[model samples]
Target: MIRTGNEYRESIRDGRQIWIDGEKVKDVTTHPMFKPVVDVRARIYDLAHEEHSRKVMTYADEETGEANAIANRLPKTQQDWKDKRAAVELVQREAGGVVTRVGDETIGEMWSLYDGQDVLNEVDPRFSENIRRHIARTIKGDPFHISANTDPKGDRSKAPQDQDPDMLLHVVKETDSGIVVRGAKYETAAAYANQAFTKPTIANWGNDKLSDYAVGFVVDLGSPGLKFISRNGFAGRAPAADYPLANRVDEVESLVVFDNVEIPWEDVLFYRHTKAAAFIRSTLHRYSALPFVQRTLHLADLMIGSALWNVKQTGLEKQQAVQEKLAQLACYREGINAHLTAAIANAEASPGGLLMPNQSLLYTGRVFALSQLPAMMHTARELCGGQICITPDSATFNDPEVSPWLEKFYTINDNWVAEDRRRLLAFARDLLNSDYAGHRLTFQLFAQSPPFAQLGAVYRNFDWSGPLDLVKDAANLSEKVNGSL
Candidate 1:
């Protein structure tokens, strides 16, 4: 069930429509804007077959007696959760940067739906069997899966019918074989990924029983009517030496337009069921949040490393103030680590009999990691000093006439050479102060969901009755207060 890097590269050359900066992209595997991340994803597939990483990236499937990706396996035990985490960490480490939405992080959205088979059966019995088959297919096929949730909702004041009906993705027509959907979704990695579990964003489904908008299905990225309009990418914009991370790990986002694209009946997981849609929106990230929050943890480590190296090069670590700042960074890193570790340890059995990280702990961990990211980035920026922003580009450092003067000022000691110092500054600058840095920060802020929706997940998951019961017992309240509990 494992594919090599070349095999993966060949799979995405499906002649799908893709455009960037008004230029058509013929091959995502080789396009300058997409190749970096595409190769990262390709490496993920290759890692499962490599000797050094295969043990961690893959497992033996009992049903087929074959090697399948650990990332796509059903989480039936706690060890499975641990193995999934290890696989994702291996990919991030190998890529030299974090790249979310490749496969592991998004496959769990389907798992979340997998856990809702009962709801699916209630609407349509075939829908339950469809999800089961898809999950199994993902394990056997190991395609580059991604997610699609948000639509470019035109206006909030009016209903979807009042405004442009295309603002939300809906079932336009149903034929004998399948349903034809027409709308657009803003999906990361859609330009290069193989498929997407397209669904609706969180919405107020106010008292509706059934509607065309309450639809969810797997859309093949190579479908005839699909068009990928991507934003301008960061790669090839500057020298790799000056913007290494951007050039190597920028995952291009795209607006995937579905112009009457047909999703086969076998691919449809749910349809025309408001209850099913609401159920999915509530539990969309149940398993996926582990990988999503883990990305933040990786970012924290990078921030800490960049800041620590800058202070070490300048001999600033000797100062107590600098040491305290470094301590704060360490605290942030370990806080994320602790949350992730504890979530798995306290894992609970999901309704579908799969093991899920503790819901309260997991959702709160996501909130803690995302809410504090901005402040922590600011702290890391301050620790790196003002030089990260002011340092000259690599071209100036390599210039013949200016090299001597620049080297004299940049070199701090025999151990810290000018070239090394410049390199660290450039790295720190890209991590903390470049256009890529800003975009990454914004991506993390709203990647899983917006701030309000994130907090709402915490609200819905946290057990408020625990506090209420304690307060009532302490105050010796009447039985009426206990009635609600």
Candidate 2:
């Protein structure tokens, strides 16, 4: 069943234990901080049913033969990769490059893959059918939002098990029906968005001591013992008039607490299976990175457009320096898009018949995104100059007494209207100066991995030998030329 936007909203109308600012939110749909993000998600659901986007957003499951979220349908061939990429790009574009997080769809897709692995391992053939049905339901139904919970709190140097064990989400007990999991998953991005589909932050390889922690399972958001403590975004509270974008795009992060939460056995994908857990994490990381690259490309496109628009609005487009800056922003945007194109073009089928992007290229793309994104933000800030900070609040500009004086003084270049120019300037301020902007910039830096770790991953995965051999061959040719002379 293709769930409509309203239907999806209705599904989560019931009470869930979500806390914000030391208070439990009674209605997540109506909460000031959560409502805007929910609206954004609703747009995604609406797109799935729209005539124009339905084809890209919805896909028929080969296993169940039902139309579902393209995210949940694993890509099996080269065309499959293209189709999935198209779907991802469509969502990012529809959101106006505002919704940059790619994990939204990727997490569920990873879970579906893990579920498939479980189904294959089941001794009874009937369990495979059950698993297939579960996947179909997950794809078709509105599952809760997904957030990867890998960043264990505290010092990064310690292994998860070696660190304060309680900091990591580990299993406490087991039951006939399910297992009891206790501990917390921190910095979860979409804790307030849905009712189900949440899982642990990272994979637990089951050594004897870590056996209980090796569990992976799903739970409804309103499950008995689950609790969510929400965190604020920059746009959470500026007066609606002062910060319009803040009101619309305020994303909330929360610490998802599982206090002896019972997760049913059937839903458990990996338990006391360290090897499988490692595979699950690695597989998810590899596949999920592609969509993120696509999303980053979208963001680059927006930043570039916003920078260019600001330049033109300020009448600086003709300046050689301004044009050069715009061109640099354009180059960064195109570079990201180029890498995405390469990753998609070089995709290959996995053992499970799912299409996987080239690991090296995909990792390289992520590395580039993490390094390039902050500079892109910096460039936007540099181009906009002091104007972003100096722009008066919308309310001040709207005041009858202050309006004429402010407009007369602030309006730049005879071609641009004061109001229009102010709006763009305000937007740039919100983009670069606001807390939301800081959070977004921080998110991009560490989304795939930490900056240094990302560099390490690139070094480990990249084939320096081939490039070195080429260099050596060139050197030999140069040496031979000198000898001949």
Candidate 3:
């Protein structure tokens, strides 16, 4: 069931239309903007076949004895969650940076729908069966799955019918074979990914019992009439020596245009059912938030490392103030670690029998990690000092005429040479100050819906009955108030 790197590469070369920077990418595997991340994904596939990583990256199926990716397997026990976490860690370690929107982080969204099988069945028994089939296929096929939920909703106040109907992706009509959809979705990694669990971004479905906007389906990236018009990629836009993360692991976002793209009957997970859409919207990140928040933990590590190294180079690590900042960063990092660890330890059973991370802890952890990211980055930037921004590019260091002066100024000691200092500064710059950094920050902010929606998840999941009971008992509330509760 597992595919090799070459096999994964060849699968995406199915003549899918992809455009970036005003040029149509001929092959994403070789395209300059995409090649780096594509190679990272390819390397992950290859890792599952490698001797050292095989055990961590994949597990044998009980029935067929086929080695399926551990990332795609349904969680039934605590060990499965731990293994998935380890697999993600292995990937980030190998890539030397964090890359979100990759396969593992997204596949869980489908599993969320999988938990809503009863709701889907209410709309159509076939819809529930479609989700089960897809989840099974993901285990057996090893496709690089991703998510697509947000659309370029034209105006918030007006409905789709009032403005551009294509503002939100919706079914245009139904054919004998399938339904044709016309609209665009803002999806990360869509240009190079295999498929997306396309769904609605609307959390409030209002009073409509059924509408065309209430649709969810598995969209094949290579389907005819689909166009991937991506934003300008960070890779190849700057010198790698200056912005390594950007050049190495930028996951390009695309406006995937469904120009009358047809979703085959088998691919449709839900249709014309607001209840189905509402169900997905409410619980979309039930499982995926674990991995998404985990990535932020990795980002915190990068910030701490970059800042600590910078301070050490400047001989400021021993200062009490400097130590305080480092301590704050540690707290931030461990705060995330604690939430992840506890969520797994206290894992709860999903309605569909899958084990999901404790929902309240997972959601609160997401809010903490993302809500504090900007401030944390700022603190890291301050610790790194102004050198990260004012530092000259690698080219200037290589200039023979300027090299001597730069070396004299940049070199702090024998161990801290000009080149190493420049590298650290460049890394810190890319991590904290570059345009890529801003984009990544924004991605984290809205990746799991907006700030308000994240808080809403926390509100819905956090148990309030215990606190209310405690308060009522302490105050000795009247029986009327208790009855009202």
Best by lDDT: 3
CA displacement after TM-score superposition, residue 181 of candidate 1 (Å): 0.5
CA lDDT for candidate 2: 0.67
> How many clashing pairs per prediction, in order?
0, 3, 0
Error (Å) of candidate 3 at residue 244 is: 0.5
lDDT: the better of candidates 1 and 3: 3
Best-to-worst ranking by lDDT: 3, 1, 2
lDDT string for model 1 (189-261, tens) is 9988888999987654679889899999998898899999999999999999999899988988999999999
- Candidate 3 C-alpha lDDT tens digits along 28-134: 99999999999989999999999999999999999999999999999999999999999999998898888987648999999999999999989999999999999
Q: Model 3: residues >4 Å from true position, as ranges?
A: 203-205, 483-485
**Which is the better candidate, 1 or 2, if ranked by lDDT?**
1
lDDT of 2 by residue, 143-255 (tens): 64465455345554666678777667788778988878887765444455553343445543434433655555556666778777778655467775556567776667677
Q: Estimate each model's TM-score.
A: 0.98, 0.87, 0.98
Question: In candidate 2, residue 4 scores what lDDT?
Answer: 72
